[model samples]
Target: MPTFTTRKNKIVLTDYNYRRDIENRLFMAELSILEVDVLQEIINGSLKTTLTTLADNLEIAPSKLRPILDKLAKSGLFQIQGDGVLVDKEMRKYYEAHIIKFDDDFRPDMEYLQGLLSKAPIHALPSWYAIPRSSDNIFNSIIEKFLFTPKIYERYLQDLVFDNPIISSIAKQVFAAPDYKISASALIEKFGLTREQFEEYMLFLEFSLVCCLRYVKTNDVWEEVVTPFHEWHEFLLFVQNTHPVAIQDVTPITAVYEKEFGFLNELNAFVKKLLKKGVSFTNAPKDLLEVALLLEIAKQEKQKIVASVYTEDWLKKTRADQAIILYRQSLNRLIANEQFTSFSEKDLREVEKSLKNFAHGKWVYFEDYIKGCLAAVGSVLPTSLVNRGKRWKYSTPNYNEDEREFIKLITCEYLMQAGMVATGYHQDKLCLCLTPFGRLSLG
Candidate 1:
C-alpha cells in the first residue's frame, strides 16, 4: 500500500498497488476470444448478419454459435431478431460516425484498433473535483509539456531523472520515506549543500515539471516540504484532495499558452459575440471541425492577423485589399495543411517553432523554411534531397500513423477541453474558432 501523511496528504511511493474502482474495472472488462471474433464478424458484415452466415463465417455450427449470440444479446452488445443478430443501434451509430467500413484490406487494422481501445485507460474525476480549476496543478504542467514538447517528454520518461541528477536524487529520498514530510533544512543538511544551492535545486525540480514545494508548519516555524508524485493514480488522488488556489485563482496552462502570444481574452469574447446569433453545421464532423480550427489558428498566427481584421470593419476595406488578404490566407492555409500533414512526431516542435517565428507577420515559403529548420534543429530525417525545390518532397520521412493521430487527438479534443477553442458551424460546415482565452495560445 502507498503511504501518505494525514495532514499534508503527501504520497510516499513504495509499491504501486493502485486499484481501480468497480465502475472502471467493469468498464475495462476484457472480452473472451470468441466474443471478440463474433463482434469483428458483426462489424465486418456491416453490423448485422443472419445466424447461418455468422456461424458459417466462424467455421462453427449454428448450434454452437447460438449460445455466444444469446450471451452477447444479454450483455447489450447485440440484438437478436428472428433469424439474425444486429449490433446495438447506439454502438453501431458511434462506430459508423468514427470509422470507415472494415473492408478486407483494413479489417486487420480494425481489429488492432479494437485491441488498442480495450487496453486504453479510462480517466474520470469524482463529482466533487471541479474540472475548471484542474489546470492549476503539477499534472497540468506535465500535460502541457507532453502536448507542446512530446519528444522531449518521451526522452525524460526513459529515465525518471529528467537529465538532472540532483533533482532525481532528491525525489528518490522523498519516495524512500512514507508518510513523513521531509523539511527544507533537513534536505539541505542531508545533501550537505548551502541554502542557495538547495533552493536552486528545488527550483529546477519544480521548473522541470517533477516535484513541487509546499509549506507545512513544523513547531514554531513554517518549513518547506517536498513530496514525490511517481504515478498518475497518485496525482489524481492529489488533485482530488488538494485545493491549489486557496487564495488567488489561476491555472498554469492559461499562462503557459499565452506565453509569447497575448490575445486570449479578446479572442474568447469575439467568439462568444458571434455565437449569440446562433450557428449550425450541416455536414461537418466534430473531429474535422477541430482540425480545421487548428489550421486556421496556425494560419492566423503565421499571418499575424490583428484583432481588428476579425472585426466587422474588415468588410469596410476595399475589394482589392480584401481580395489580396483572402487570397494569401487561403493559399497559406493549403500550404500549412500540407506541412502539418507531412510532420513527423519528432518534428512537431519544429513546426511550432516555425509558426512562432512568423507571429510578427514574417512569412516565408512553408516547405523551404521547414526543411531548413528541420536541418538546423538536427532532425533525424534525411536531408540530402531537401532543397530540390520539387513540390511535396519529403526527405526520408518516417510516418507513424499513431503519432499523427495522437497529435490530432490532443490538439483538437484536448484544446477544446482547455477552453482554448469553441465549436459551432459556419457556411454549412462545422467550425471551430478561438475564444479570446485561446487567441494568444495558438502557436
Candidate 2:
C-alpha cells in the first residue's frame, strides 16, 4: 500500500509499503494497465456508468472495451447491467475510503512505479539468461514472481514475445534496428491506436522493462522517445548505467558486467539444454555467493574506510572498486591453490555422498533432500510425541528447519545460482535436483 495524495491536479502515490510482496505479486499479475485505468475512470465517475461512457472516458471503443469489462466483472471488480457497469460495493468502499479521489485522475506517477520496482535493476543480471531461455518465467525468482503459468507481459520483456500482432510488430521493429526510436504520435498513428491506448500500452511495455521511454515537454506538448533493448546484454547494461538515478537510497555497485555476461552465457546454455529436454526449474536461487563472500571480506577490512556509521562504511566499501580488486585477488589465490574456500573437506564429502545417494532427474520433496543430507552425516531426528500418521510432525527441538535453512543456503542460495542445482515444485512441495552442469562439475 502507498499513501495516495493529490498534488497540482495529479495523483501521487508516496510512502510505499514494501512489505507487500504477496499482494504486489498478485496485483501486478491480476490487473493490467488498461484495467487499472478503466477502474480508475469508473471510480472517478458516478461509480455507475454505461459501457459507452466508460469507453469514451478511457478512449477505448465500446466493442474493444467490452471484454475487459466482462473479465473485471467476473473477477468481482464491478457489476455489469447490460451495457452499464457498476463498481463492486466492497471494492468501491475500499477505494474511496483509502485511495481514490473525486477530482484527480488515479493514474500513478511513473516515479512511484520505478521506486516500487527498484529491485528490477538487480534482476537484470539473471534476466540475461532468462530472456533467452524462457522469457516468460519470472527471472531468477527475484523479479516479479509470476507463479504457475504467467500471462504475457507479466515481467521482463514478455510483452516482446506477446501473441498480439501489434506488439509482435513493435518487437520486431525494435530488434531489427538498434536503438530504435519512435515518437509517440508516429507510433500511435502507425499502430492505429487511440491516444489513451498508446499510453497504456507503452506504459505496460516500460513496466515490463522491455524498453525505456524518455519524454520531453516541447511547446506544452509532451513527446516520448522509446529506446528498446537491441541485444540481450543491453538490458543489464541499461539498468547498470541508469541505476544511480532510478534507484534511490541505493548505490549501484560497479560489477564486472562483461564477466557476469560471460557467466550468463554459460548458464543460458545449461537452461536451454534443460528446456529442450522438457525440464525447467520452477524455483531457482537468488543472491551471489561471490558477492556475499566479498562483502564479508569488506566488513573485515572496513577499519581503513572512513564513514559516519558502520552500516554506511560497510555499504560504501563492500562493492567499491578497491574492494572488487581485492576480492578478485583473493578469489584467484584460492582458485590457484585449489583450496576449499567456503567449506571443510569433510562437509563437502558428506554433501556429495548425500546427493549421490539420490537418483537425479526426478522430483523429491525439499525436506526429503534436506533429511537425506543430514542423514549422510549421521544426524538423527527425534521421534514425535504422538503416534505417526500419514503426515506426522517431528518432535520439538528437532533440527529439521535449522538444517534445511543451512543446506538451502549452500545448495539453493549458492549452488543453484551457480547453475549446479535446479529446484521446482512437485505436488505443491518444493523440490530440487542436480543439473547436467552440476553432475559434470561434481564428477
Candidate 3:
C-alpha cells in the first residue's frame, strides 16, 4: 500500500507495499512502454475521464485502447464506473511520481512493440542471459513451493495451465509434440475459446515462463516454445543445502537477475520458514530468512546495512534504506568501471552522466556489456558463466564505435583477466570478491 502524494505537479509513491514478486512478474511480461505511459496519463490527467478522451490524448482509436485499459484497471489503479473510468487517487499519484523520477519517456507504444516482438526472437547472447524476467521465477524457487513436486510441471498443471479446459487441451497438444513447437491448428480444435481467452493464455504463459513465441521459420510465424530457457534448471539447485556453485557456474543465463532479483529471495525464504511452522493460514508467522540476501550483499562488499530497515516491506523502506540499495548498486558499477580505481565526485558524476545519456533499456549495447562486466566481476549483479576468455557472436543492435568496444573489453573481459576482482572458493562455489582496488573505489 504505497502512499501517493503530489510534489511539484508529479505524484510520489511511498510505502511500496505490494510484493516485489508481483512487480517482477509484471516487468518480465514485457509490459509494453505504452502501458506504462497509459499509467502515467492516468496519474497526470484528469481524475475523471472517458475512454474516448484518453484515447484521443494518445492518438489511438478508442476501440484499440479499451482492452489495454481494461486489463490495467484490474491492477486496482482504476475502476470502470457508469460511463467512464475513475482512477484511484493515490495510485494515480504514485505513478506520476515514478514517471517524474525516471525523467525518460519509456512509453511502450503498443503498435510498434507488437510488430517488433514478432520480429525479435531470442538470439545467441554473450554466453549469459541478458537478464531473466520475473526474478521470483528465476530459479522457480518460491514458485516451486506453490507447485507440487516429483513432477514439477504437474504443480501448475491443475491450478493454472489446465485450469481452463481450452488451455489445458492446448497444453496437452503442445506437450505431445516432439519439440516445443505445436501447429496452430492443433490448438484451435474443439475449445471454442473466445479471442480474449486465447490472448490471455498466451500472455499468461509468457509471464509464467512456461513458453513463448520464439518464432520457427518452417512454421513461418512466432510459435509458442515450451518452458523458456532450459538452462534455468541450474537455479533449482538452490533449493537444496547442496554444495555452493560459484555464481559463474550458473549460466547461458544472464547474471543480472540473480543479483537484481536477490531482493525477493529474502521474502521467499521467509515464507517457507513460516510454512514450516505449520501455522494457521490466517496467522502470519515469523520470517527467519528475511533480509538474508541483503545481508549477503553487505557481507560480499565488506559493507554493513541495518537488518530491520532493509528487510522491512518496500513500502516501509526509509529514504536511507532505499539509498543503501541504490548506493550499493552504484558501488558495484564503480568498482567494475575502474577496477579498484577511486572515484572522485567527478568520477561519480560521469557515471551519472552515462546513466542519464543512456537510460535503462535505451543503450542496449552498453547495458548488456555492463551487465556482462558485472557478471564477470560477480558484483551485485550475477553472471551465468564462471570462466572468462571466450567471445561469441554477442548479438545486439549495432551501437558500434571503436571506443565503446574498447571500453566493453576493458570493463568486462579485462577486469577478470587482470584479476581486479579477487576470485576463489566459497562453500564449494566460485567466489569473485572485490579486491583492494575495488574497496578503494567505494571511497
Candidate 4:
C-alpha cells in the first residue's frame, strides 16, 4: 500500500490496487510522450502550462503539440480549456497517493487478454510478405489460450492481405476491368499464397471493390466500360517512362503527377497524336478551361506539376489583359457621359491624365491618373472595403470575400505547383497540404 500527506494534514492510504489498475490500463493503451507528460503533470497538480509552453518544453512545434493535447482531451483524462488543462478529479486523486507496481509473476486480467487479442492482428502483419511464423504462432497461441472465436483468425488473415502492398496493387489493377471476375484459386497460384491467405486476400479485395464501385455509382459512371487490359498496358508504359535508374535519387514531378492522374501518360500521348493531326490552341478557350479545371482537380488530388511559374504567369497576364480591356471600355462609357461637362479644369485634367495612364499599359496608378478609372472601378467596390493605407505603411488590396477566397485557392495551388508547398483541394472550401511522404514522392 502507498500513502501521501494531504493539505488537511491527513494521511491518505490511496487505493494501491486502483492505482496499479489505472497505471496498467494506461500502459496497455498506446500513449505518446506528450500525453504521458500531460497526464502526470495534471496528477501532480502542477499543470500550469499552455499548449505553446508544453510544445517549447518538449522541443516540438506548436502544430504537432496541439494534436497530442487533442488526443488527451478526447481520452477524457484531461479537460482542455482556452487557458489551460485540467485533470479529472477522481483520476488525479488516485495517482496522488498511490504508486504502480509490476511484479515478475504478475499476469494480465481476462479483459486485458481480450484487448490484447483484438490488437494482435495489427501486430502480426509485417510490411514485407515474409511473416515470422514464430511471432505469428505466439499471437495465435494467445488467441487460442483465451479461446477466442475463429473470427480472430479471419481478422489476422484480412490484415495480412490489407498490409501487403503487392496484393493491394494487384487488386487495384483488377478493379479497372469492365466485368472482372478474379478467381481466388488463380490469385493463390499466381502469387504463391496459401488457400487461407488467398481467401483473406479475396475478402479484402471484395471490400475494396465495393468501395470503388460505390464511388463509380455515385458519380453515375457505373455503366461506363473500362478496359482493364488496355489500362494495365498503359500503366506499364507509364511505369517505364517514370522509372528512375537510381532509387536514391529523387523522382521527377512529371512522374509523380502521372502516377496520381492515372492514364495521364496515355492522355498526353494521345494529345501528341492529335497534335500530329494539326490540333491547335488558337480556337481552344474551352479546351484551355478544361485543362485548367483538370490542373485544379489534380492539385486537389495531390498531383504534381511539370510546368514553371512563367507559363502560368503568362496565362494569368492574358486573363488580366482581358479584364483590363473590360475596365477601359467601362471607363470610356463613364467619361463620355454628359455629367462630366460641369467638372472644373483640374478635375477634367485629372480625368484625362488617368485615361492616358491606363492607355500606356499601366494598371497601378490608373485611379490617380484618370477620373473615369475611379468612377468605373470604384462604382463596383463593396462598402465593406477596409482602407488600410492610412493606418499601415504598405498598400493592401481591398479584397472582398469572393476575391479573398479566390486568391487563397490560387495562391495555394500556385505554391504547390512551384514546389514551395504541397496542397490538395478540400471540395470548394480550402486546400490541404500534402504529408512529408507525399511531398517526398513528388521530389
lDDT of every predicted structure (CA atoms): 0.41, 0.43, 0.39, 0.34
Give the lowest summed-lDDT range of ten residues in model 2. 1-10
Off by over 4 Å in 4: 1-28, 45-48, 95-443
Better of 2 and 3 by TM-score: 2
Q: Estimated TM-score per prediction?
A: 0.25, 0.23, 0.22, 0.18
Candidate 2, residue 125: lDDT? 30
Clashing pairs in 2: none
Highest lDDT scorer: 2
Off by over 4 Å in 3: 1-21, 24-29, 100-443
Global Cα RMSD, each model: 26.3, 24.5, 26.0, 28.7
The predicted structure with the larger lDDT, 3 or 4, is 3
| lDDT winner between candidates 2 and 3 | 2
Which residue segments of model 2 deviate by more than 4 Å?
Answer: 1-111, 114-160, 171-181, 192-197, 203-214, 227-443
Model 3 residue 304 lDDT score: 23
Clashing pairs in 4: 300-425, 353-369, 354-369, 354-370
lDDT tens string, model 2, 259-290?
32233344334333333332212222222223
